[model samples]
Target chain A: MDNKTLEQLKEKANIIRKDIINMLAEAKSGHPGGSLSAVEILTYLYFKEMNVDPTNPQWPDRDRFVLSKGHGAPVLYAVLAEKGYFSKEELMKLRKTGAMLQGHPDMKGTPGVEMSTGSLGQGLSASNGMALAGKLDNKNYRVYVLVGDGEMQEGQIWEAAMTAAHYKLDNLTAFVDNNGLQIDGTNEDVKNVEPIEDKWKAFGWHVITIDGHDFQQIENAVKEAKETKGKPTAIIAKTVKGKGVSFMENQVDWHGVAPNEEQKEKALKELEVRI
Target chain B: MANIATREAYGAALAELGEKYQDVVVLDADLSKSTKTSEFKKKFPNRFFNIGISEQDLMGTAAGLATCGKIPFASTFAMFATGRAFEQIRNSIAYPNLNVKIAASHAGITLGEDGASHQAIEDIALMRAVPNMTIVNPADALSTKKAVEAAILHKGPMYIRLGRLGVPEVYKEDMDFRIGKGILLEEGKDVTIIACGFMVHIALEASSMLKEEGISAEVIDMHTIKPLDEEIIINSARKTHAVVTAEEHNIIGGLGGAVAEVLCENYPVPMVRVGIKDVFGQSGKPLELVELYGISAKDVAAAAKKAIAKK
Candidate 1:
């Protein structure tokens, strides 16, 4: 809320970005572009917005979060490790056979993951289910999900959007990481997901657009989402593909390719100097 | 013994189960009336969710409910539940080993009139491929009721296939039902006739037909297809030395394929598979379609004889 808190979150985001590079560099294969793009969103949720206990990860009353764009698991794993959900040691062993952190977000293997998600567009529906259960049980805990901009091409997202609005799931807030680039190319080149904000509105969701890297805007949108009633909110977060890194920034080639040793060094150095 | 659709028994059993387990929730993809989850909806309106026609959302939402310590039974036509939402069930429910029961009705050619598009001849094979998924194809009304109760008692993902056509009751009310165990209805030394779903009744009829021929065919109702009753299958195959499997599904990967795999690996018996022969169904009366699809009792009887001859 204040300059000190915002500055602290920014520092935390820088550290998480470095961790993403390091984890991907070690694993030799992962989505670094999307993970870096979603650093601020994950940092803000774990550090400031959400009410979760790392010690009691399965606390029933705790707020739940789903990483809808599950290929961006590096960011989630980094954030969860930072929050002490598991050891920071597990971050390196990601995607390894018999490791706790899977290639995708596995709720059973990972302590902080709310739902197992890798296949796109299914997380919002799972979020709606959790929100519906919360309403049924009369629990005040909210549900949050982060979906990729490219992930919007999935029809299940709209189906879930209709469900959330039809059920009046005010407790559910979704963030669309509009990084504008996918694995193939730019979203425009691959499949235009433009009129994105209007699409969520047409689905009866309260839409809010924000600069994803800005902590203050991310905070305000989450706050407004909580106060809104009778409908769920969709925060369309405009972000750069690979926000903090130099060579990877807005590069389509970085989508699923892990950085080599030299590239990882460059990326980490850039993150260190950015703040 | 009353004739009732397995879906109807499912509806009644779900309503009863809802009263006993307050955490039991039902979700349907706009086919609640057909799926018989409407009965559960009528009993627990607040707990039931009609997820519109979105089968993908239906499965994902059910998986979400399961994470919250609720036993969510997601229902739809078997075609949609396993066919359309295969990935959702795999990644969301089965992958997590979630406590979501997929009670899919209108399975097989017996769904009738809706034709090939609606018939789920490959559902068993699809579900069988997924790890941590337990496939239960119950025969008749009483077994369907017991299957519902067992699904609630069992944790993790389960696919309970039900039928639209009313079938003659093969078991009494107090029949012993277990998730992975098969029931031996009649014992014979010549050949074993293994069947699931509505085919169990046909298998019994085939056994009687074999009796007239002095073949002495054994009848076994293999309700649970996955985590299959391998012991019963191996033991029976060893004694009979011949096996015939009948199912209202594709012979490639249904009860027939499962039985074949067991016998070939463990007991190595002469086996004949009586099923759809890898063809889709056409719109017709249920019994007419059953006969036309080559899954009739006479078909099973002939298959049993063929297996016996091979032995």
Candidate 2:
């Protein structure tokens, strides 16, 4: 976590953000708000945290990541592409017919997608399954999953929450992208998901709250999660709905609507200046 | 022949299979005792996961285990497995074509006094609609055991429907069992009785009754409902010229609907269906419920006669 390394990581995040904008713009439809909000988390995992080999995507002992909030697939696709899991050119063909990158994260079609998740609130359970297998097989590989703040409304999430803790899945870490806004409106306007940290704690998890955009906090939380034992960890990441793009930031309307060419230009220019 | 519940056979088969396949894992949604997954649990407690009463998590966890090369058999009542968590089975398991076996017990009205809420009379239709899902409704204990073994060997999602009632054995231990092929139990020329699950036994009884009436009846045990034994059904229809379908499920979509579809497309024949007449069941004994639901041997015989008269 040196200053130089932090700066490099920030630059990579910006590049990923730009890629998200371009991908969504090209596809003409996708959830850009949540994808942009999760850029730094995805960047840290793929670049600095996860022990995944691009060439051997299906390596038995490799760390696995499930995008539970699958609407934010652009962020994962960008990060995977940057990690050389696939060519950067494939990012542009996302959500298009005959493209390897589907509208949702399809594990069969896309490389580095550990599980196919689109319907919300199922990823943590799937991650727990992998972690349980890892423990059974005596493998040291960890499991990570990213869930949306709005996606917490699903009852299955709580069902899986109890399961992860009940199994004492210490190897599993879940990130709740608390960007506030959902498709219809803000979380407060929709169904409120406040007391998220206490909820995870009550469900028998080690809870860590952090400013999601901060790389130092992100790194520290991951390190602490690895150090903890006997239970899973939930990293409640407080992030903006759209982080890099000023126009889309905290905007509920941008939750699923793709950015037009003019909006895309503005978003990319803002991201470039950050780098 | 011994009378054993299909769920009991599933449990015994899972215990036996656990010794052979080290990668096998069993998951249950707190119905281990009822669903008979407790058999696997007792044999391999470390490999068995009781996922509480949450069927959604049960299915999702099984999907996750499948991705890691573990053969996960997720068990619950057919009502909950196919109804409560249908989306989980569809998106997480079947959409990816994972190697997960949804061995649901207590299918149809035969689940008895738990009544209509617990009975999954339409599970076959629900499972059959999902792509890449192999539906196997075994007729007896031996076939249930074979179906569990076949599911382990098969490399995709499978729904093995098991019953709660103790059914008479329809096959011996050495009976040849295949995934998508039908087992022709009897042959005749008047009418063909295609049945699945507990209804196969009733169909056999109906065939005997038909013989007493001087009508030759053919019976086929269609264990695998999806990727259905179309060849057997078409050939049997051509020979018999009339067909009767028997199932404990609704006549709308179960073995009857599947057979009717195949016959209509391939070889059109006069068909009559013997099942629940598009209605729910009430609390009663298993045999009493079967009789009241109009899925007994007498009903199959009457339906067979109606089909023959139409021909």
Candidate 3:
């Protein structure tokens, strides 16, 4: 939580952002909007918050993370590589056939991913399962899941929310990347997932809101989640559609489109100066 | 040992499995009493999870539990387990090839009075279409018990369908039940009647009727639908030169379709299917529905006779 540590995490976040752009530009297709939006959150967790051992991804006592909003695999793939779960060469093979990094988070193919999630709105339920299992085995490992704001349109998320709170799975924490924009348009135009915080609160989750781009608030929210008991926590992270790059920021067109050569060069240049 | 419903056998087996396997966990979507998962819930209260009327959450949560090394038995009425939560079961549990056992109760038309809405007539077909899914529809209570035990020992996703009606005991308690291996109940030469679930019991009765008519009929308990017992089916089809498939499901995609796919490719035979002729069930007594839906013993006998006549 020190300034020095925070600065290091910020530099890591910029690297992750650059990786996201580079992978998408090479793959010729991937979700860039949500991936960029979640850079800081993934960077913070992999670097500081989560008790994950990249060297031993299957360590039983280690905390588990499910990328529920799995379209953002580039971010997770980049962070896992940066954290040494796999080599940096695997990042270049993103979405390629016979690659460890799939189009979505595949737990079997990838080392660090805890659950195979691509279809949205199902990750939180799986996270609940991990937390519930941890409690049953009397283990102290916590569970974390990252969901998208548009993913909330699916009813299963609410059902899982009720389940997590009902079981008093205080060991679980979920982050909704409230990037405000989805594939079709703004969340308000697509399905209107506003009053998002109140929705989680009504579902009995200990709700927390934070600027997702800020690493300090991300770490503090995770700490607060661990301190709370007898209930799950939902940290509604407010984020821009594309956080770092100039042309892609707050743009719905970048939700799934890959960048061209010129655009990728420009984005990498901007991130380089930030690093 | 006793005549009981398949659902009842599943509940008792679950409670017994709880004592043997500490990592075994049970989950239901608010129909514990009806599905009989309540028995396991009673014995292992701490390990039981009732997600309360949400089948999607029930399946996804079960997948999570499986990931953590907990062998989760997610149970519900077949209609919801395979019908309502189809995609969740496919994407969350089956796609990952997770070690989750889905023991769905009240399968087929014998669920009675609740009619077609509750009856999971096509549950097997739905489950069979998914990759990495093993489908087991037990003949009677005893087989249901053995199937549940085998499902737990197997290290992947399995769909064990149980019926609501109490059926006559077919296999003895000491009978060895192996997955993907058909149980030949009776042997004959005229025609073979391959059946599953409640229809297996009727196939036995139909074989008796065929015996009286001087037409020898072979009876097969085709329990495992997916990873089907092709050896037994082809062997029987080749021997009898005629076949009849019976089930408490639509004739289109259930056991009949599976048998036809196997026979048409391997050993072609004149086959007649006795089932719910691609129509929905109406509110009636379980027996009345069986007779009305054309899946009763007499119907199987008729289908067998028709198939033999063709030969």
TM-score between model 1 and native:
0.99
Off by over 4 Å in 1: none
Candidate 2 residues lying further than 4 Å off, grouped into runs, are: none
lDDT of 2 by residue, A1-275 (tens): 99998988998998899999999999999999999999989999988999999999999999999999999999999999999999999999999989999999999988899999999988878998999899889999999999999999999999999999999999999999999999999999899998899999999999999999999999999999999999999999999988889989999999999999999998887877884
The residue-by-residue lDDT of candidate 2 on B142-167, one tens digit each, is 89888988999999999999999999
TM-score of chain B of each: 0.99, 0.99, 0.98
Q: Tell me each candidate's TM-score.
A: 0.99, 0.99, 0.99
RMSD of each: 1.0, 0.8, 1.1
lDDT (Cα, tens digit) per residue for candidate 3, span B61-171: 999999999999999999999999999899999988999999998887878898778988888889989999999999887888889889989999999988888898887
DockQ of each: 0.90, 0.87, 0.88
List the candidate 3 regions with Cα displacement exceeding 4 Å: none
Q: What interface RMSD does every candidate have?
A: 0.5, 0.6, 0.5
* Per-residue accuracy of model 1 over A1-275 as CA lDDT, tens digit each: 99999989998898899899999999999999999999999999999989999999999999999999999999999999999999999999989999999999999988999999999999999999999999999999999999999999999998999999999999999999999999899999999999999999999999999999999999999999999999999999999998888788899999999999999988888877755
Determine the C-alpha RMSD for candidate 3 after optimal superposition of all C-alphas: 1.1
Q: Looking at model 3 chain B, which ten-residue stretch has the lowest summed lDDT?
A: B168-177
| Docking quality tier of model 1 | high
**Which window of ten consecutive residues has the lowest lDDT sum in model 1 chain B?**
B167-176
The true-versus-predicted C-alpha distance at residue A91 of model 1, in Å, is 1.2
* Local lDDT at B270 for model 3: 99
